[model samples]
Target: MQLIAHRGLVRSAPENTLAAFADALSCGFHGLETDVRLSADGEAVLFHDRTVATGVPVAAVTRAELSHLAGYIVPTLAEALDAFPEAFWNIEVKAPAAVAAVQTELKPRIERQRLLLTSLRHDIMLSMAEALEADTGFIVWHRPAALNSLLYAAMPHAHLRTLVWYYESIDLTLLQQANALGFRNYVFGAQTDHEHRLCEEFALHGLITDHPEFVGLTVTPPLQ
Candidate 1:
């Protein structure tokens, strides 16, 4: 199973910053996951929320304005790709507007195998899957979507290449069912030691976590 650093080892550095992503790679994480949104300038920026702390919508501000405002350095998607050329990226398009910008930025720089594009919006994920050749995944955060995901997984032409669920929403049965259907299963928001152990016991494909070091250590036992 892959241990993906959520927001680039958020505990070590500011979430979604180049620094945070670099730190995760330096610590031997298998990959990094980040949220992407479009700035007012239509630039792909690394940010998690629809709005910043000031309650200003991210799309309403330019990249420079966002960089100066605060606690974290919001790196552009271009900057992140350049900074970490070899690391596998799980880029989440937080808004529909970001899909195009992200596609334009990533097209020539990396191959599809090195990236996984995901979104909570099924339509956006479908759009991205059509727009780019990258591996696409759907994030199921609610019960309705989870049920739908299962049904979708059973379909022969289901575009869902992967299915990620809220860690709390998944159970052994779901994991088995997804695996049986040849769907790669991943979980989000799995931060605790116990959760990491659960991921190992179930043999999940990967998990997103803020504390990669703690989870990695728990999942990687001594050779002896």
Candidate 2:
């Protein structure tokens, strides 16, 4: 199973910062996943939330200006690519428009093979899939909801892949369902023997957790 460091090995460093990504690389995590949002000033910054008390969106500030913020400076997508040239990037674009901006920045520096473009928005995913060629893969971040809803519209398509970001428990049936469809599975810190059993049963493509060292490591039983 591929181990993807959620938020760039968040255990060692601040989440989604250059420091976190560097730590993930040093520790040998092959793929790094992070969220992107636009700052008020039109700069694309690496951040997860919609807004903070400062009343400013991440995109509003440039990397240089955001460096002084106490929370964490919103980094441009470009900065991340520069920081880790060889790493596989799982970038979740918060807004559909961000995809175009990201592509514009990424195209000149590296080829599309190293990146996986993804979004929860089906329209955005479709737009990106349409804009880019077949080689550039698009993944859909999945959530639990009514099966017939608008969000699940992309699940039936072959090109659309599913990435589970968060979960309270490991439901083997769900993982099996995902596997049956040939979609990749991701779980957050299922660092236990039981979870491993589920992972093994489903043949997960990848696992995400704050602790990278425990990945693929056997989870020993607790004291009786």
Best by lDDT: 1
Score residue 110 of candidate 1 by CA lDDT.
52
Model 1 TM-score is 0.89
Off by over 4 Å in 2: 53-55, 71-73, 108-113, 134-152, 155-158, 189-197, 216-224
lDDT per residue for candidate 1 within 1-224, as digits (tens), equals 88788888666578999978877877788899999999999889999988888899899999989877756568998888888888888989899888888889877865533888888887887766666666778887754545444556325435456888898788787778777877788888776778778888888898888775557432233245
* Alpha-carbon runs more than 4 Å astray in model 1: 110-113, 144-159, 218-224
Q: Judged by lDDT against the true structure, how good is candidate 2?
A: 0.64
lDDT of every predicted structure (CA atoms): 0.79, 0.64
User: Going through the candidates in order, what is the number of backbone clashes in each?
Assistant: 0, 7
Q: Cα deviation of 141 in candidate 1 (Å)?
A: 1.0
> Cα deviation in Å at residue 4, candidate 1?
0.4
Model 2 — which ten-residue stretch has the worst lDDT? 133-142
